[model samples]
Target: MTTLRDIALIAGVSGATVSNVLRNRGFVGAETSARVREVAQRLGYRPNPMAQALANGRAPTIAMVFSDLANPFYSMFALEAERAARRRDHFLLVCHAAKPDGTLDTAYLGAVAGRLSGGVLILGSDLGRADLLSAVPNGVPTVLAMWEDAADHPSLPCVTLDFREAGRLAADHLLALGHRRIAVLAGARGDRVSHGARLEGATARLREAGVLGGATLEEDSIGGGHRAAMRLLEAEPRPTAILATNDLLGIGAIQAAGERGLAVPRELSVVGITDIWLAAEMRPALTTVDIDTRRIADASVNALLDLIAEPDALARDALRIVGRPSLVRRASTAQAP
Candidate 1:
C-alpha cells in the first residue's frame, strides 16, 4: 500500500508535509502541498486507517455528503442509505457538507473524502461538478448520488432517478383535471437552475397540450416556494394550479393558497415532485411524484461499494439510473375551478 513515506519520497517532501497535505492542514506551502497531493493521487494513496482495516478482512465504511440535512427528503434518503449500507455489511456516515450560504462546502469534503471515510456518496444536484472534482482526490472512490440530469455525465460514477419524468407526471396530473392556467415554482441552487430537468419536462408536457405556464425561480425550500406562490396568486386572473419542482415547494404553495382564502383543489391546485415522508403527513396530503428514494439510496450505496472494490470502474464512468418517477395523487389536487 502506498504510504506518506512513498508520496514524500516521490515529491521530495518530508513525511510531515505529506501528512499535512492529505489531512488538509495549513502547515505546507501551496506548491509543496499541491505536489504532495498530486503524488498521493497518482500513487493511489489513502490516509484512512479504515481502508487498512478492510485489507485485513474487516467491514468497510463510506460517507454520504449532502448539502442540507434539515430537508426531509435528505433525511429520509440518509435513513434508507444507512439501511442499504448495513445490508451490504458496510457502515454509513452522513456528512453535512453545505456551507452557510447553502453551496457545496469543499473544505469539509477535502478533509474526509477517502481519508476519514473509506469512500463518499455526494447527494443533490446543487453542488457544482468543478468543486467536487477538485475537492476529492483522484484515487478516492466516489459516486454522485441523486443527480438531477442523467444526460449530463459527471467526472465520477453516478446514480439518479429520471427527474424529468417526475416533472411530467406532476404536469400530466394537473392537466388531466382540466387545469389550463398553470404556474411553476422552480427551485434553484443559488443562481444556477438546479431543477431545470423537472421544469423542462413539465413545460414540454404543458406545451404538448397547447398550454403555456409561467414559471418563477426560488430557493429549493418551503419559504422560497411560499414567497413565489404569494406573488403568483396576485396575478390578474391568477393561475388555477401551481406546479412546484419538489414537495417542499408544493407544500408551501398549499399553505399560500390557504392564507389567500383559496381552497386547494377547489380554487387552486398544487402538485410537487419527490414524494417524501412529510408529503404524505401534510394536511390535505401532498400530491407529488414518488421518485422512490429508497431504491435510489440503495443503488447509490451499492454503486459506491462497487467502485471501492474495483477502482478501474471509474474509467468506465458508470451511470446507473434506478426507479421511475410516479404520481402520488392525493387531496391537494382535483378538477380545476
Candidate 2:
C-alpha cells in the first residue's frame, strides 16, 4: 500500500509537509501543495481514517436518526441532510431509529455511543420518549429536526416546521372549495400524529366553519389510509373531501376513491400534507401542503455542526429554528360535488 511517507519521499518533501497538504491543514505554498497532491495521486495513497481521527482527536462523521425511509418525506430530508453534511467534508450515518410498529428503537441511541460519530441529528418522530435526550453522550452535540414543539426540550437545539400552519393550509384550501363534509386520515388517537398540531389545526377550522367532521385514526401509511378511507366512505353523509396527514395517506385516499368508482376532484377531493415528489404525478395529482424538506435538513445539519464546534453555546442559550409550510394546489382537490 502507498503510504504518506512514500509520497513525501517521491515529492522531495518532509512527511509532515505532505500530511499538512493532504489534510488541508496548516498553510502550505500553493505550488508545494499541488506538487504533493500530484505525487500522492500518482502513488495512490489513501489516508487512514482511523489514524486521522486519532491525530485530530475527533471523528469526521455525524449520525442522523430517523423513522422509516419508506416514506418519501423522510427520504427527501435524508438526501438533503446528506448533501449538506458532505459539503462540510463530514461523513453522514443514517440510522433507522423507529421500528416497523412506529415505535422508537430503545437501543438506537445506546448504539450510537459506541461509534466514533461526533454528533447526532434526530428526527422528531423518534423523540417520543422523554428520556431519549438523556441517552446521547454528554460531549456529543445533538439536534432535533421536524419537531412541532421545541419547547418540550428547553435546552436542546432543534429545527422544526409549523405543523399547525400546515394543517390550517390544507383545511383552508378544502373549505374554500366549498367542501363541508371532510374526514382526516391520521394515526390512532393520542398517537401524536405529526405532533398532534396538524389534527388540532384542521379540527379548529372545521369547527369554525360549523362542519360536522371528525378524524379516523389509523396507521400512518398508504395501506392504513386506504383502510380508513374505506370506512369513512361508508358514512350516512359521505365525505366530499379527505385531508390526509401525509402525502402517503393522500395517495392512498386517491387509490381508495378509485376503488369505490369515485372520480377525484369530482365526487371526492383529497388533500395531503408534505408534498412529496410522488404527489405531483399521481393519476389525479394530489393537492397537498409543502414543507421545505431541503431547508429543514440544511438548517438542522448546520445547527448540529455549529453545536459540535461550540458545545458551550448550548449552555448559554438554546437554539430553535422553525420553517414554514405552504399549500400546493394540484388536481386532486376541487369544488364540493
Candidate 3:
C-alpha cells in the first residue's frame, strides 16, 4: 500500500507536510500541497477511512440522503456536494431513501443513520414529514439542502432555493417575449410539491398578464417532457410557449417540437429550470432559470461543517439559507410567431 511517506518522498516533502495536505487541518504551501496530492493520486494512495475513523473517534465522511437519484437536478447537486466535501478532506456516502415509486423506504433510511457519524444532508423528499424525520438519526449534525413541505426538525438547518421566484422569473421572461399561450410541465399538481410552487408562481405572473395558462403533470424526465409536449403541441390551440420544470424536460420539449415540424424560437418557445450544463449545449440552446447548484452545495457543506464544529449551536435558532435563481435567455425562446 502506498503510504504518506511514499507520497512525501515522491513530492520531495516531509511526511508531516503530506499529512497536512491530506487532512486539510493545517496550512501547507500551495505548491507543495498540489504536488503531494498529485503524487498521491498517481500512486493510488487511499487512506484507510475506517482506521482513521477509529483513531480520530469520528468519521471524516458526510452522509447525503437523496429522494430522487435519477433526477438531473439532484444528480448535479450530488456532484457539487461531493466536490465541496473533497475540498474539506472528506468523502460522501450517498443514500437513496426514496424508492422507484417516489415513496420513502423506511427500513433503508433508518439503516443509513447508523452508518453515519460526522454530518448529514437531506435533499428532496416525497414522504410525510414525520416519517422522513423519524428515519433520520438524531444527535448527528444534519442539514436539509432542499426544503420539504413538512414540519421542520429542530436540529436541522436548511439551505434551499427560492423555487417559487425561479418559476415566476421564467414565466415573466416568456410573457415578456409576447407568448400568451403558455403551458407548464411539472411532476405533480399540489402546493405541497416544489413543482407545484413553481407552477403557481408562473401562473401568478401569467395571470397578471391576462394570459390563462395550462399545466401538465408528468414524470419530470426527458421522456416525460417529450410525451407531454406531443399532446400539448397537438391541442386545438397549441401553446406557443412551454415552461419545463427542469432542463431535462426542456430538452425533451425541444425534441417534441422538432418531430412536429416546428422550429424553436420561431414557431414554439421553451424555457426550463435548474439550468443544468446540458441546457446550454442543446440545439437552439435552452433558456433556463439557473438554480445555482454550486451555491447550494457550498451553503449545505458550510452549514454541515458549522454544525460539526459547534454542536451546541444546534440548540439555538436553526440556520436558514436560501439562494435566488436568475433567468438565462438563450436561442430557444423568442416572441410568439
Candidate 4:
C-alpha cells in the first residue's frame, strides 16, 4: 500500500508536511501543497480516517437519525442534508430509527453516542427517547429536525417548517372551494412535530369556518392513507375533500378514491403536503403544498455547523428555522360540484 511517507519522499517534502497538506491543517506554501497532493494522488495514498480523527481529537463527520426513510418526505430532507454536508466538506452518517412497529429503537442511541462528533441531527423523536438528549456529551452540538420544542434539552437547536401553517393552509384551500366536509389523513400517532401541528391547524381552521367536522389520524404511508380515507368515505356524509399530511398519503387517498369509482375534482378533492417529484406525474396532477426540501436541508447543515462552532449559543437561545409552504394549484382540486 502506498503510504504518506512514500508520497512525502516522492514530493521531496517532510512526512509532517504531507500530512498537513492532506488534512488541510497548518499552513503550507501553495506550491508545496499542490506538489504533495499530486504525489499522494499518483501513489494512491489513502489517509487513514481513524488516525486523522485521533490526531485532530475529533471526527469531521456528522450523524443524521430519522424515523423512516421510506417516506418520500423524509427521503427528500435526507438528500438535501447530505448534499449540504458534502458542500461543507463533511461526511454524513445516517441512522434509520424506524422499526417494524413504526417505533424508534433505543439501542441505536448507544450507537449514536459511540460516534459522537461534528454534530447530530434527529428527526421525529418521542418522549421515550427524550432521555437520550442528555446522553449527548457536552460540546458536541445537536439539531432536532421537524420538532416543535426541545422538551428538556433546550441546548439542542431545532429546524422545522411552519407545520401548523401548512395544516391551516390545506384546510383553508379546501374550505375556499366550498367544501364543507373535510377529513385529514395524519401521520403516525407519535409523530408530534409534523403530524401534530398539521392536525391542529386543520382542526382549528375547520372550527373557525363553522362548517368544521372532524379529521382522522393515520400513519404517514400509502396503506395508512388508503385505510383512513376508506373509513372516512364510508361515513354518513362523506368528506368532499381530504388533506393528507404528506404526499405519500395524498397519493394513496387518490388511489382509494379511484378504487371506489369516485371521480376526482368532480366528486372529491385531495390536497397533500410536500410537492414531491411524483406529485406532478399522477393521472390528475396534484394540487399540493411545496416544502422546499433542498432549502431545508441546506439550512439544517448550516445550523448544525453553527451549533458545532458554538454549542453554548444554542443552549442559551432557541433557534427556530421556519420554511414557508406555497400552494401549487393543479387539476386535482376544483370548485365544489
Candidate 5:
C-alpha cells in the first residue's frame, strides 16, 4: 500500500498538505492540490480505513517543544521534523517552552506531553534530567532530542548525535591546516543547546596536540561572535583560526575578520559545528561539522511514534542515537599563513 509519506516523498509536498488535499478539508492552493491529487492517482492511492477512523477520532499533532526556535538550527530541524511527522500521518506542534530566564517551563511541558498524538519530543533546554523526567506524567510517551552529550544517558528516550565528535572534527580540521594560534569562541551557557560538551571535545583535541587553545564565552549568535572575534584579533599574537561551537558564531567571526581588513583563509581561518544551511550561503562558506540535522529529526519523530506504539518499552532506558558529525571543509578554512 502506498502510504501518505510515500506520496509526500514523491509529490514534494508536506504530509499535511497531502492529507488536506486528499480529504478536501484545508485550503491548499489549486496548483499544489492538483499536483498532490495527480500523484495519489498515479500511485493508486487508497486511504486506510483505520487511518480515516483515527482522523475522525483524536488529536493528530505531536508536540515538538524546543528550547529556542529563534535559532536557525532549530528552525532547520523543525522543517525536517514536520516532514517526518507528516510522513507518519502526524502533524507537528512547535512550542517554545522556555521561560524568560532560559529554563524549561516544566508546567508548560507537563500540560502538553503525550496529550496530542499520544507523544511529545522535547529538544534541548537548561532543565535537569530529573526535572525533565518529572515534567511528563508516567505512561505518557516522550523523547528528548538535540541533546549535546550522547554519553549522558538521561532516564528518557532520546535521539541525538555524537556532538563531542563534531567538536573534535572541527578542531582536527583546523589543526591539519597548520593553524596553531587558534581561538575557541564558545557559546554562552544555557541557551538553545549548550556547547560545553563540544567545547570539551575541541579543547581536549587541542591539548593532545600540545596546543593550549584558549577560549572565550560569547552569546550563541553572530553578533556575539563578532564581538569576541573583534577582541581576539587585537591580541599581541593574533589567532590564525577560530573554532566556534555553533554556525552563527562562526559566521559572525568571519564578518569580524573582514571588518578588520583581514581576508578569510588568507589571514584568518574559522570553523564551526552544526552545519546549518546558512553556513554554505555565507560569502566565505564556513568549514563546519555536519551533525546530520534531518536524520536526527526523522529518527526522533520515528522514535516518538514507536514509543506511542510500545508503551512497555518505556520501562527501561530507551535511546536511539543517530548521525555522526563529520567535517565539511568549505572556503572559510585553509592552510595557515
Candidate 6:
C-alpha cells in the first residue's frame, strides 16, 4: 500500500516536511510543498486521521447533529454548511441523533466527542438534555441552530430562526384571505422551538382576530397531516384553510383534501412554512414562508469561526443572529369559500 513515507521518498523530502506540507502547517518552501503535493496525489497517499489529530491536538473536522437527514430542510442546511466549511478549509461530519426507533442516542454522541476541532452544530432540536451541552469535551465549542435560547448553558452560542414570527405570518395570511376556520399542523410538542413558539404565535394571532376558538393542531409530517386533516374534515364545522408548520405537512393536507373530494382554494386553502423547493412545484404551487436555510448555515459557520478565534469573548456578548421568514404568495391560497 502506498503511504506518506513512499510519497516523501519519491519527492525527495523528509517525512516531517511531507507531513507539514500536507497539513499546511509550519514552514515549507513553496516549491517543496508543490512537489510533495504532486507526488502525494500521484501515489494516492491518504493521511491517517488519528495520527493527524494526535499531532495537532485537534481534528480537522466538525460535527453536526440533526434530528432527521431525510427532511429537505435539514438537507439544504447541511449543503450550505458543507459549502461554507470548504470555503474556510475544513471538513463537516454529520450525525443523525434519532435512531430507527426515533429515540435520542447519547452513547453514540459521547463516543465521537473527542476528535474534533471546529466544534459542533446542533440542528432541529436540543441534544436530548441540557447536561449534554456541558458534557462536550473540553476545547470543543458548541452552537445551537434553529433553537430559541439555551436555558442552563449560557456558554453555548445559538443561531435561531424566528419560528414564532413565521407561525404568526402563516396565520395572518390565511386570516386576511377571510378564512375564519383555520387549522394548524404542528411539529412534535417535544420540539420546543418549532412546536411551542410557532403554535403560540399562531394562537395569539388567531385569538386577536376572534378565530382562535376554531383552530386545530395536527402533527408535523405528511402522514400526520393527513390523519389530522381527515378528522377536522369530519367535524361539524370544517376549517376553510389549514396552516402547516412545514411544507411537508402542507403537501399532505392537500392530498387529504383531494381524497375528500374538496377542490383546493375553492373548498379549502393551505399555507405552509419553509418554502422548500418542492413547495413551489406542487400541483397548485403552495403559499409558504421562506426560512432561508443557506443564510442560516453561512451565519452559523461564520459565528463559530469567530468564537474559535476569540475564546475569551462572552457568549452573550457575541453577535446574536436570527433569520426572518418571508411570506411567498402562490396559487394554494385564496379568499375563504
Count clashes in each candidate, considering only residues at least 3 apart in sequence or on different chains: 0, 0, 0, 0, 0, 0
What lDDT score belongs to each candidate, Candidate 1 first?
0.86, 0.80, 0.80, 0.75, 0.85, 0.76
Query: Which pairs, if any, clash in model 4?
Result: none
Predicted candidate 2 versus true structure: per-residue lDDT over 1-337, tens digit per residue: 9998899899999999999999888999999999999999988888898678757666777888887777687788889999999898777888887776556575776677426677888887545655555556666688878876544543467677777788888999999999988998865424655537777778888888898667877777788888889888888788999999888888888999999999998999999988889999898999999988888899888888887777765552365555688999999999999
Best by lDDT: 1
Candidate 6 total steric clashes: 0
| Candidate 2, residue 22: how far the Cα is off, in Å | 7.6
Candidate 5: where are CA atoms >4 Å away? 1-58, 125-127, 190-193, 314-316
Question: Deviation in angstroms for 156 in model 5?
Answer: 0.8
Q: Model 3 over residues 1-337: C-alpha lDDT tens digits? A: 9998999999999988998899896998888889999999999999977667756656778888887767777788889999998898778888887776556676776665535547778785454556556667667677877663223433356677767788899999998888988988876523344476677778888888999887787876788889989999998788999999778888999999999999998999999988988899998999999978899887888778777777775543365546678999999999998
On residues 244-294, what C-alpha lDDT tens digit does candidate 5 reach at each position?
A: 999999999999999999999899999999999999999899989999999
Which is better, 1 or 3, measured by TM-score?
A: 1
Off by over 4 Å in 1: 1-59, 314-316
Evaluate residue 308 in candidate 3 and report its C-alpha lDDT on the 0 to 100 scale.
Answer: 76
User: Residue 76 of model 3: what lDDT?
Assistant: 86
* Candidate No. with top TM-score: 2
Give all TM-scores, in the order shown.
0.82, 0.84, 0.79, 0.82, 0.81, 0.82
Ranking by lDDT: 1, 5, 2, 3, 6, 4
Return the lDDT, model 2, position 263: 95
Query: Taking the tens digit of each residue's C-alpha lDDT, what string does model 6 give over 1-337?
Result: 6777898899998988998899888999999999999999998888787566657666656677787887887888899988987787677889886566455566666655545445777674534455445455666666667764323223567776777788889999999999998887776634333466666777789999998643445556778778777877786688899888788888888889999999998999999888888899899889998878788898887676665556654374243556688899998999999
- Candidate 4 has what TM-score? 0.82
Pairs in clash, predicted candidate 6: none
Per-residue C-alpha lDDT of model 4 across residues 46-139, encoded as one tens digit per residue: 8787567746665667788776676676777788888899897777888785566545565665566435556777775332344545545555
Backbone collision tally, model 5: 0
lDDT agreement of model 5 with the native: 0.85
